[model samples]
Target: MPITRRQFLAVAALTVSVREPRAYAADQEQAVFWRAAMPGRNANVLFGYARIDASLVPDIVSDGKRLIDETQRIIAAFPNVEMTAWDLPRRTLPPIWKSISRPVADELRAALAGLPDGVPIEELSGIEVSWLLMGEGQTPPNPYLGDVLARHSRSRGRPVAFLITEKEIREQFWLPRDPIVLNDTIDEPKIAFLLDVRRRVGPIGAHLEQLYRARRGEEIYRFTAEIANQGIPDPSTFIEEEKAGALAFDRLLGLLDSTDAPTAFVVLPIGILTGETGILPRLRARGCTVTPIV
Candidate 1:
């Protein structure tokens, strides 16, 4: 029998529990690193967006392959160019604000008044509530500063937009873990394997190789059983899972600012690319030619 996408996510989540190795001298040197001078005139950054759905794992995998194909084509057209691909890792919501602050709880209650009455608002933090409302295309109060992003996503001949959210800042945001970059020159086979694993196991498998490299053991028995018995979470829960994606976008922007590579191609979840989070605007302000992938 084949493993399902949900199973893959459950397994991936389990890997997070493994005790991370303590810092070592060799580990410091082993950190993955790559940087280059910014691109000169005529260089454009490419942004790719795809909706994430466990039931539509095949479609998600196809979209990723398309993004990679387009990126390779771009690289081939430009000489003396160095490209970096960043995989936005998944994030978990911290304890709800009720556990820490009353003011945050009051704000959440007001912002999420539109949610279904049966929904458990108390279980969610203010941020998670905001993200859920946004996921549904509803604008939350004080949504990210700035106008909608990727306004020229289509005009630039980027990928087709499969999903669109009404307010961008309502998009989820979280802090990112350490950064890692995979190079095609030395890790071609590994790259192929990563893609194949994602095809079989879904997006969660996308991080499998990286987790293994960090010495996170592949202990899937418990996770398999847990996913087998699990049912789909409510909409609020689903949106909570997406909050980390926002942080991933922020992390990518930081990388763009630090590197000299004139152009960058980021493959991210659709919501993060299109939301009002000001990512597109911020990138453009930095003088980047932004083209979004469908």
Candidate 2:
């Protein structure tokens, strides 16, 4: 069942009113708490999106193991939740951002056949959502899936949201930027999955939003994409593959340096790259919170 915002608030009040710090482990079993509220946000619904962009930034990309460990810690900290944790591979076709360029709507419908039916269309109200994790030289096609998802989301009364950490990747929206590429087409399974999430979360979010609004006496609608298990290899040695990873990382950092929304989540597999440099420290230094998927 969905965790209402009011119930969440009551829990929050209790945590705040407490004074002693709690232990993390219990009975030598890594100390799992029984749905205790985290100090901050109580994310009732956590959708872990699968990421295909496994490349790492040289000297910038952090260790994959560390990323996983930290993320585990984060999840452990959250208490009381309606969590959908699933994992799938990044799309092998055109990249997610460029999925719309090809006549792939039908392709998408087919691709998502095996996914769990967690959300319904009526709940979405016809909103389309988009997802992607790449930027720059590896640009996807225009009128990308983001546009498609937005159109679907707005029209459907459903909110479509993407999970990414790179501010530079999304800069074109808020900044005066040039077209990423005049002509380019890549696999865009991420976009397809985004569309899928829209469909899944549409009904759930719509219902939750309605309930949240009534309980809070205001609008509080936020949709989530529950991601599942993903695997990334070594992420520290990403610079070793500098030719491929560095370019994307450089552009991403550049985008971050120039933008204001510093905090974002990049939902990639933990087994994709190899390296010592992790992406977390860089994000933290920039005041960005890093969330990883196992």
Candidate 3:
């Protein structure tokens, strides 16, 4: 059975009294307090996300083990509450002609040419190639590639949390980014220009429009092709990335709402929590208690 919000707060207050000042201490007294405080009502939820600076925290990119550790320490404050982590999934390419790189296209064309007119499309080794061959005109036969690409692109680089308990607890959730405009054809020069603009003025809407307008028609195509050849110069430049953050928060809220837990504590990077694209306000509007741990 789910516990009411008021009951959860009462338990939270009791747990706080037993929490130790030093978060990293190894004393067994803290464990005893947690065991005593365990109520049959519902487990609390704690969520964390980060945007780390490699220069300051040098080891941040190496699978985020250190960040996970720190998050575990923070979760220790809540007794008997199970913790989980969420992260973005890998990115994959679509089977659309536009998404196909020049080299891959050439290979597919050559492979098709080698086969007889009536040869089965099933002979193709890759799913993308088979779909493209059977597809009509320039578009793919179905949106399979588009769907896969969408899922991958939206989920790439999202954050997850892990429980920091002595006993092994294996539970996790993935927070996928919301779908956004994916212009794969932006070239390097334009990417460089955009990166420069972002560095100089940040992600101002007017500034981006002004810079984009300055480029010629041919330049835009060239830029688009370059981006298609490569990936988005920087994922942060796209408005969708920001929207993904909000989507992640929404997922967290949904998870909390579905359970009987009284309180859900979310930890996110200071930058993500305070910016124009931040979702902290939305979370608060939904009655979540927000705390910033910097």
Candidate 4:
């Protein structure tokens, strides 16, 4: 199936969160959103958000709005949003599906057999596939920071920009993975666990929702690392995607060098900000300070 508007934005979301940057300490309460600057005129703020469409997210959205109001410059994730890009793990669907082992495919198809909007395995794309495979309980019918904030900034005809282009992102996923390793990472056990997570909120989702709602960035990061360790496998295809920070950091520097004011960046799944090699820490090395806002 062709990717939908929502699916397209979701593709960009892959760059906005997950995929790479590896380090962190659990004890410190790291701020996901911040006013950060290197040794220059840039004091751009980065707001790392969770993808959950819930009521609590709006509070963070309001804070994000304040940052936008202050800077008047918002660097969004979507083609000039707004080429659309992939979400984590299940990225580049057709090929991933093509590689699926027979038994696992049968199980996944059978599991989706009873869902209300469930379609034949061949029909799924973007979030639908990922949600069915991994998400828990239900999604609240509310807008997330990505939905409400990204659209609002663009609609107002404000100074909107993107740190990473859609093509650069899509190309990142094009890098090949060893199918042998791939099958090992996403085996039947992994599928079953993900299916379990799909039905019940499970401990990670439950705690993650709390941390995300509470705006606990560092905790979220630590928890995310924990989740990754606890058997939630990240696909090998995303290894190349981890290098996104190098380009993103360079572009952000260009924005900082060329501009006279602060810029704002939005990241989904706030925890993606943690990893040792994460861009924020790199900024710190260059005399940039990232101060927590919420």
Candidate 5:
């Protein structure tokens, strides 16, 4: 019998153990160790807008695939996902005003008038949201500020899990011919940033390898999600730019005006469980299959 995508996701969920490992002597000793950087220049940044809900997940295939499909949809919709890097400083910005400052209170008081029903606007006062919007298409040397762009990683308890392609490389793009000069400007590293995604269904067999193969030369793909305003873009724009950030944002933009889609992977999440088993049984009943991302 063949497996479906839902089944694969189920297996991924069962096999996946996202618990973070305890700090070892080496990890503790190396306080200054830098995290591994992702491959490629601009096509490595992952921009995900996921809403976390503590409520229990539902079992229907529609619901299970909804999570997977939506996440993937956001990843797909995101244009130039790779080149979209953020240069947030390691240290967070300091609070702008003291708690007792009247000016701050005054601003909050004025802004509180337009409150949503059942929500207290007063709760937001004095709370430094810290989140802010920095524009897109900014040139480098002025590395992106406000947001910290990082590779996607998932957690099981505390330990974070990263996706590794069974094939040597997951995806590929062209690089500059003059390798030495290119290497001089950017600090190139060996390892790449790992994004973590969990499985919602149960385990399966060799299908993961086949999905990996199918992904090797894929030019066009799709992702679906329930959340409407995921803040993602179309793929056509990304293909047109040939990846602006891949070269240099400034130079790349100069060559191409459209800052539409960011070229990158279309990450999605799916599930299929019922009863206490969560989404697992539903996946099996439907004969769905999943791919292993170990």
Candidate 6:
């Protein structure tokens, strides 16, 4: 059953300042990953999605000798390390200073315009107003899956490794800056820019949480291709997903080739491992037998 937002925050130790996104089903061992423990199978991996947590599935952190997560985003959102969390707000003031951009101002205007007047939006900035429309300062129910698993692994004395660095991840998520508009005067991702300053991106985000909780991997790929198909909806679409999965898979391959200890879990985005160009197919192509572990 979908837990309430308060329960979700307590269980996941995370927050998203948005309307309640449905939690994953109550399967204790619910997780997504292909195990290639066939002949010459040197590694054990658990491919994971970023947002859903143990509140939704208790055994999220698969038994791993050592963990290899995809990026530092997982570590950043870790329960022990959330204070350094990113995603700050915008600048500027009223009808005079004009600190925020036109897009922000326009979206804020339209969003407030949708509500009854005398609403007292003077104190709210663009992102704050957007959050007000979306919900509040609490995050959606889906917390960082990779971090949850990582934290669990650490607690169990299991070692952890990162497939990429924070710089690399920042680079991967980096977006070209708009010359005119200055959101914190940095190059904000289109997805982030539109989201942080967007009018109505909450519904699509909520729907995504629904799809993810259902564990319909291939359906997720197709769903993006058909419905909320955009860079904003899912920054890692077909090509990017393939490239990322393949790159991570290759790194795992090399790591396994070098190490004797088996991989405890190989955390990655579900979208990166489901479609034709995803990790599982590539693993199969390499002659390794793939089996669904969790």
Off by over 4 Å in 5: 1-51, 54-62, 65-94, 98-128, 132-294
TM-score top scorer: 4
TM-score of each: 0.26, 0.19, 0.26, 0.66, 0.18, 0.52
Ranking of all predicted structures according to lDDT, beginning with the best and ending with the worst = 4, 6, 1, 3, 2, 5
lDDT of 1 by residue, 1-294 (tens): 121233223222212211122231111111111122224543333432222232323343344344434331222111111112123322223334424346444544554576678765555432333224223321221321111122223334444321223233233321222222111121223223323333445443233333222322222222222222222121213223344444444555555555343343343322223222334434555666554323
TM-score comparison, 3 vs 6, better candidate: 6
Among all windows of 10 consecutive residues in model 5, the one with the lowest summed lDDT is: 189-198
Q: Per-residue alpha-carbon lDDT of model 3 for 1-294, expressed as tens digits?
A: 111223222212111111111222221110000110122323232322221112322222222332333321222211233322112132343323444457554544553564447744333223223222222122111332212322332344323332222232222212222221332343333334433433455432222222222312122223233322333322222123333454456555564455453332233322233222334445556666544222
Candidate number achieving the greatest lDDT relative to the actual structure: 4
Q: Which candidate would rank higher by TM-score, 2 or 6?
A: 6
Question: What is the number of residue pairs that collide in model 5?
Answer: 51
What's the TM for model 1? Answer: 0.26
Pairs in clash, predicted candidate 4: 11-85, 11-86, 12-85, 22-276, 23-275, 23-276, 78-81, 78-82, 79-82
What are the per-residue Cα lDDT tens digits for candidate 6 across 126-219?
Answer: 3233224333222344545555665655656655556654454454533333212322222223323444523344433444455455655655
lDDT per residue, candidate 5, 1-294, as tens digits? 121223222222212111122221111111100111122212222221111111211122123233332232122222222332122232232222333346444543443343337543343211111110000111221221111111121211112212222121114332212222322222101000000010111111122222222321111011111100122111111122233222222222221222343332222221111121212222223332212221
Candidate 6 segments whose C-alpha is farther than 4 A from its true place: 1-31, 59-144, 170-175, 179-202, 227-246, 256-259
Candidate 4 residue-wise lDDT, 161-244, digit = tens: 676767776666335444334434544455555555544555334445666677676555554453355454333234355566
What residue pairs clash in candidate 1, if any at all? 37-260, 38-260, 38-262, 39-262, 47-293, 159-294, 160-294, 168-275, 168-276
Q: Write the per-residue lDDT of candidate 2 for residues 188-234, one digit (tens) a residue.
A: 44444544554554432233323222221111111211221111111
List candidate 3 segments past 4 Å from native.
1-55, 58-233, 236-247, 257-259, 262-274
lDDT comparing candidate 6 with the true structure? 0.42
**Local lDDT at 118 for model 4:** 48
Error of 3 at 219 (Å): 31
Candidate with the larger lDDT of 5 and 6: 6
